[model samples]
Target: MLTTAEILRKVRALEIKSKKLTTDLFTGEYHSAFKGRGMSFKEVREYSAGDDIRFIDWNVSARFGHPFSKVFEEERELTVMLLVDVSASSLFGTIIASKKDIATEIAAVIAFSAVNNHDKIGVIFYSDKIEKYIPPKKGKQHALFIVRELLSVQSGQKKTQLNTALRFFNNTTRQKSIAFILSDFIDTGYQDALRVAGNKHDIIGIKIYDKMDRTLPKLGLLRVEDAETGEQKWVDSESKLVRYEYEKDFFRITDYSNEVFRKAGCDLLHVRTDEDYVKILQRFFISRNK
Candidate 1:
């Protein structure tokens, strides 16, 4: 647990980092990437020479016997939901930062971007079970509160169940939203839920990983521990066969995940802990806008 002073300090640091990121990278890209619901009808206006004939208001035109056009306003407000994985696997990292830290930082950047664009942001923290849910809201204070929670919230357990989180999100949010699921994706058997959620929401998955996850270091014999299960085992990392098998497993898992995302019609972005996340995010936003 963090003391009050410690929490305050962390909050301040995250605010500075997230605010700078939002301003520098996402200001324009985020605004143009996603759109709200369909436009709403506004007051009619006199038809211009080049106005579309399909939008002509027959009632108003007939009343005055002059061409009039129906005007519509774009719905500017949007809802952005961050589905964060707080499972124990997020604690692992062989790079500059842990998976949890990367997830938290990315979540903060997206949340700040959403608020800057006058959109509501929400979060659903899960670890096999739902830990906490902060409903959709707008403003800097809300974004800061979410960052605080990301840094401090404790899960009741330390396991991964992506299906549970997706089911909960599907049940809770009735309207369509833009949702970002940030996780290491160590678990399986969530394809159906993912498909369902993707059908309703604009869903994107950000897969956080470390270099060591793909290949084992030539450290001879080493004891490995599973973060989620707390299981331990000794592995001969120096052996060629062991390293080959490890790389094969890594590729298999990644390929399966990619196929699932493709079938669900959801976008997936992979980010390593030691890499620059800002560039990854900027590319994603630009692609989304395109």
Candidate 2:
């Protein structure tokens, strides 16, 4: 649990960092990646040398006796939802920051990015069940409120059941939204729910992980407890077979998650806790534009 003062202080720091990243790096990429509802006609203008012939207004051109183009602008009103996982597994970290910490930062950045683009932002915090739902709204205040909640929100349950969150999100939000799911994705059996959400909304997954999740250190025998289930087990990390199995399990989970997103027609990005998430996000946005 975080003290009120501590939460406020961290929220302030995150606000500054997220806003800076949004302005200096993400604004343009985010805008291009997640487009508006559709294009609306603005007016008609005289066609220029390079203007597309397809847009030529036949009536306007006939009346003016010259080629005229129908100008249109993107209707840039969009809703962005952050489906954040607050499961116990997210607390595990072996490097600079915990998975939860990185998820919060990235969520803040995404909120600011959406706000900058004049879009509404909302959040759905979840563990094994729906923890909280912040309705979508526009303005900096709403975005800031989301940042604060992301830092302070807690869940009663430690397990992760993504289907619960996705179903709740679908029920609450009727309009198609740009939804980002931030999680370590340590659970399974959510494929059907994910596919349903993907059909209705634009879904993207950001998988946050730690280095230790992929490879265990050779520290001889050690007792480890399951963060979610509270199950305890002893394992000899020094044994090659034990280390191999640990690594294999990690990859197996990764592969399942990858396949789920791929089959659902959604994009998924992996960010190690210690790696540069900014670069990964930038690349993703740029690739979407292409």
Candidate 3:
């Protein structure tokens, strides 16, 4: 467990980093990436060149005897939920930071970006079950509180039951939202839930992975532990067949994960532990914009 002071310190540092990313890098991209509910009428204005002809107010124009345009504002107060995986697998990382650590940073960045754009940000921390849920709200304080939870949440669960989190989100949030699922996605029985949630909300999948997960270095005998199951086994790393099987298993798991998002009509991003997440996010936003 993290102490109060430690939690506050981590929250403060994250606030600084999130603010920088929200302000400097993700200022406008986030807006374009996640759309608002709908457009609302602001006011009528005189028609100008390049204005969409579709928005011309014919009734007002007939009354005022001039071409007028209807200005509509995007109902941009969006609700963003972060469904984070706090399972044991997220604790496995051999590079710079663990999967959970990287998830915290990315979740903080997303929270800050939501608040920066005057949107409500919420979180659902889960590991086989719902560990914590922060209701959606707009404000810096709410976002900060979420960041604290993201950094300090401790769970006894060791497996990831993604369907539970998705079902909760689906039943709780009545209105449409931009939901982001951050996890290594090492689980099963979540396809129906994902499809149901994706039908009503704009869902995005962020796959967090470690480089070692894909490749195995031949160093004679090797011991591997499954974090979620708490099972350990020894394998002949030097054997060609063993290494080939490991690589094949990695590919099969990754492929299934990718297909889940694709079939759900959602965008997916793969971010390794050592890669630049900012560039990855920026490119994702740009692609959505196009």
Candidate 3, poorest ten consecutive residues by summed lDDT: 31-40
lDDT of 2 by residue, 181-256 (tens): 9999999999999999999899999999999999999998999999999999999999999999999999999999
Sorting all predicted structures by lDDT, with the top scorer first, yields: 2, 3, 1
Q: Write the per-residue lDDT of candidate 3 for residues 1-290, one digit (tens) a residue.
A: 78999999999999999899989998799998876556779999999999999999999999999999999998878899999999999988888999999999999999999998899999999999999989999999999989888878888999999999999999999978999999998787788899999999999989999988888888989888898898999999999899899899888888888888889997889999999998999999988888
Model 3 spans > 4 angstroms off: 40-73
What is the TM-score (0 to 1) of candidate 1? 0.90
Candidate 2 whole-model C-alpha lDDT, 0 to 1: 0.93
Please provide, for model 1 over 1-290, each residue's C-alpha lDDT reduced to its tens digit, 9 standing for 90 to 100.
78878988988988899889898778888878875445778889999999889999999999999999999987788889999999888878876999988998999899889889889999999999999999999999999999999988777688999999999999999978899999988788999999999999999999999999998999999999988888999999999999999999888888888999999999999999999989998998899777
Tell me the lDDT of model 2 at 122: 95
**Which portions of model 2 miss their true places by more than 4 Å?**
36-73
Query: RMSD of model 3, in Å?
Result: 3.6
| Candidate 1 C-alpha error for residue 153, in Å | 1.4
Candidate 2 positional error at 160, Å: 0.3
